[model samples]
Target: MWYNQFRKIQKAGDLMGMTVNKELPLPADLKSEEPLTADIIALKQKRDREIRDIFTGASDKFAVIVGPCSADNEDSVCEYVSRLAKLNDSVSDRLVLIPRIYTNKPRTTGAGYKGMLHQPEPDKAPDLLAGIIAIRRMHIRAIKESGLTAADEMLYPENRSYLDDILSYEAIGARSVENQQHRLTASGMDIPAGMKNPTSGDFSVMLNSVTAAQSSHNFIYRGQDVTTDGNPLAHVILRGGVDKYGTCIPNYHYEDLMRLLAQYQKRELNNPAAVIDTNHSNSDKQFKEQLRIVSEVLHSRAYNSELKKLIKGVMIESYIEEGCQPIGSNRVYGKSITDPCLGWEDTRRLILKIAEEA
Candidate 1:
């Protein structure tokens, strides 16, 4: 291996002095194309209103965001969304259901699907173009069939045009919230947005993101000069942090959130509310703990007046079935294959419990 490495190094020097590698042809200029339609806008507006009503206390409904940790299979994804849509109507009055259509998955070590964007290969086929096509097709079909609005974590700004028409809500993940490009994208985004805090769970970073996303800003959008309306609905999501951990077993630490809410009100921010991500640090990335955290939050609302108004929604990483399997494996149907998740039975019971309490 050492001898091969030396031989490869010599070849790299020779190649560097040889003909240069030309830029690959750019994909068709789909970036300049507009895809969002009237019907899509109408659905988006309706869902936006529902979210607003929930946060503003004009409605008694609780917001529930549930779906796969990351979307991969088009056929299976559509089927799952369709099922969620039916469930949405059944709980329509009491809950606002938002189907999570995330296509990007950021890894701590930079390995994983990265969504269907970087790897179309479910079975070792490296076709990124095919991956993009498959994901876009799945997103459109889900919107058309599910009659449900979708939410995505906006990662690649250039990829926005692909799903702009289909997405209703966008989230800036913990790692990306502090990024200027993401903040700019959030400002220009037409849909309501949520910004999560830094991985350490600092509210100030989230507050800054909220301010950036909610204020009008000038930025380039698809080779055109553009200004955004600035998504006022942008809010904070407290998934908890190790800093707030009990230094032992996992706990939601309601006091941590109460302090955050007071800070929001003190800053005179919009609505003074926060969405508790029932996954991640709040549950210590243990999927089953999601249910307990959510139940505790919902049930504790009675004594926590501040929480009653501030906790408008809960984000759960769930799918058609429970728990996760290894990526790219031919595993059980409906298993996450990404992050471990609360199984269907437990998820259903938790949702019903939250609804009953709400």
Candidate 2:
């Protein structure tokens, strides 16, 4: 009966998917091609430890994950990270700066420039095999130029092993937070994994995801069954949320922070923390509002001792130039091709201010 039903669907052409365009080398093979030296791996391990300390409340410095919204060009991304390396020294005592080298961007409609992982060149057609190699090279170069290991989104859970040795922090985006695979992958991560609240922005949903990530689980992964001991560093990132009407609902306010804190108290989460994304729905996509949002969050933290302890950091979108440009022949250099970002001048000033107060 089952075979007849399957034959019915198959014969009707319903039991099919898009054919595989090409077969690429496995992640291990790619890592071998563009390998990280033993020294680099050791340095990454140390960096990972320091980052873990900050999220676990062992370090008092506030973390700022700031950089371009999407890393499109290799030279430009490396150059931007180089600048951050210089600034890292200036605020090392008060802040731990983690540059965002997000290579895989999530598109709402499953179209447009997916990111460097899809189209290594923004305007060109996608070449996944070339894209895979391009992204790995860029990450390696960025770390070598600047002694800073950075952050990237685990946009595709299976694509993670490709950059596992490089990324210091992993973010589960607003759209993928409530997913089972994403939550499971976070548990097995050795680095900090920040899970953003879903687009609908239900606190219970976000908290539940966090709980799941921090608890042990036995699940199937990549053609094999695996058991995870859970990731204690898995936490929440409040990027604000959107309602059914597509209106952005801001959740980084003090009242909202208080509410989250109350919720955290009721749970047995480890190293309970939250990182506020100053852009996204929190700023309602008004890129310029990120500065004000960061200031307000810092103000709220200073006003409340509990908030100061629970809210560990922020995520800011910034680049060499402010605003964004569409992908075309006359695209501006260093400006975002995806989401609008804060220009360099304002980003520098904001970090200095944060260090002074935070």
Candidate 3:
């Protein structure tokens, strides 16, 4: 009988040995807690407004998104932002600064550092308590010291609430935007949220994410909440698509942008926008190519009027030094302890060049 055959396979370990993966407790539910201060709240609002204005073209200056490719040390992150703040003022009239304060990273394979949660040395799992504290504290320090808004990949949904009072912009990485949970989270986000195309770099998925983020929906939230008002600020970030060879390229061609534009038009997407990432698939993970990508964008803005207004901003992965070091290695410098980043000199040069071109 069919039942007997099924049972034979099950008993042979096809299904009998399966184990249910349990969901670990969120960081917020842990013991360590810190209430967001009024000052932080004010700063968050100010930063959000500034970013919105810049993205919508209400602000005269071009928006330049820059920060460490990935933050591994809290002190180094704060210090880097501090220097950026001083530079931001100089370019305030010509550019708006948005610091990358990403706490979570999406790895291609193997277990990579999940940010402050598994602090490098400690390597602790389910340390939700530490992760929350570290993220909130780092955000607070960056805001207080630099007065610049922070941008992060909203990899974990619950992490958003802990940073509600600090973050200005949230990015949905390529891997998660197509997920129902992420789209739902984007819908309810209080600030601007961006959705990247799928890992394979399919543009339609990005468009779908954009539409979903902007539409109101009834979804479960925080165990008791529902009714997502929709994320109006949700936009697309073209990090490039995989080719026949199955490689990540950071190339967002004019044709790609045009097709995306057409989709936005059909959806009646408000202030339809896109931000180009200079790293990841777009840059083919090459640090130098990132600089060229920005240059090309700036040049395109000057030569192509249609693209000038459409392409709103650029994202760069940069830090104090260039290249990346293996995390487990004992001898790493100020350079990205995570992904390889452009050196500070290269970053400064590119920013100044972009400013001049724009």
Candidate 4:
């Protein structure tokens, strides 16, 4: 059905002036998921188990998925992960650290840098074929070097298979969380997928997306009919929401968490959990505020035992350097080319503090 729908759109575009440019390689053709080195495989297995255990209430460790907003430079990202790899050992008992390696970024107005999956080189034109290969290679390198199975956003559901084998956790971004394809794809993945609240800030839409992802469905995926067994690990990610006045309002407070708990109870979904995105609308894109926001969330958890169980972890956007830079300017090493992110020093401090608090 998806192929047929694409054909119909193509036919209509042909009548206009649009034409098919090229056909890319299938996932299998691009890169086979040959087993990784035994050590890396063991690391992934352990990380995956810990994450699932946290969601299922079998563990009390806080999960922190932190890294660059978009992985623009491979070297800088790998360096960041190396730091996280070392830090993970220190806090392993209290926190599960999964570095965020978001390759595909959804632009709000369909403009700006679309992430490494589109442009491996920020200053060059998009070579999707090369972009595909670059992303896969980068993910492989991160895991091989850092011994960490990173988290990435499923910006394009169809493209997820390219790195699915390496990703320990997946997030359906605010813009894509409401889309049917994204939700369906999450239902089939073995890794935990966090469905973020939509831009509209509607809790029902977020919960409904979780419900869809946690239920079985038959759908057209990659030119094939596929059925999913329903992902019980599908959970919610409150990244805050934008109000009608075009303002970013927070949803990470005690009241907000209590409200989410109420909603989850009403639904009675499997492995109920929430991952609070400290940046985005919650911090109103003010990167520095992430420290305060995370500190407050931990305080809320300390205040309420139930909130601690429901709030599984937090998502943080941090890079080697502080804040963000424009796309074509002199790119700062480890600084974000997309969203402004918390700098490395503050990020390190915050993680240690979170571990201490947790």
TM-score of every model versus the real structure: 0.85, 0.95, 0.87, 0.94
- Residue 110 lDDT, candidate 2, scale 0-100: 95
Tell me the whole-model lDDT of each prediction, alpha carbons only: 0.74, 0.93, 0.76, 0.91
Residue 280 of model 2 has an lDDT of: 95
Write the residue-wise lDDT of candidate 2 on 1-358 in tens digits. Answer: 9989865666665346834566678899999999998878987988888889988999988999999999999988999999999999999999999999999999999988899999999998899999999999999998889989999999999898889988999999988998999999898987889999999989999999899999888998876799999999999999999999999999999999999999999999999999999999999989999999999999999999999999999999999999999999998889999999999999999999999989
lDDT of 3 by residue, 1-358 (tens): 9989975665565365673333344546432355556786787777778778765767656777788777777887888788788877777777777889888867778477767644533234545556667777788778888788788888877667777656788899988988998898898887778888887888888888888988898877777568988877888888877777987755566666667667777887766778888888888888788988888777766777767777778889888778988665564555786778988788877887777777
How well does candidate 2 match the true structure in TM-score terms? 0.95
Off by over 4 Å in 4: 1-17, 33-35
Give, for candidate 3, the lowest lDDT window spanning 10 residues.
117-126
**Candidate 3, number of clashes:** 4
Against the true structure, what is every candidate's RMSD?
Answer: 6.6, 3.5, 6.0, 2.9
Q: What is the C-alpha local distance difference test score of candidate 4?
A: 0.91
Question: For all candidates, what are the clash counts?
Answer: 1, 0, 4, 0
Ranking by TM-score: 2, 4, 3, 1
Q: Give every collision pair in model 1.
A: 322-343
lDDT of 4 by residue, 178-203 (tens): 89999999999888999999998888
Rank ordering of all candidates by lDDT, starting from the highest: 2, 4, 3, 1
Residue-level lDDT of model 1, residues 259-303, one tens digit each, is 777688778565566777888877777788887788777876667
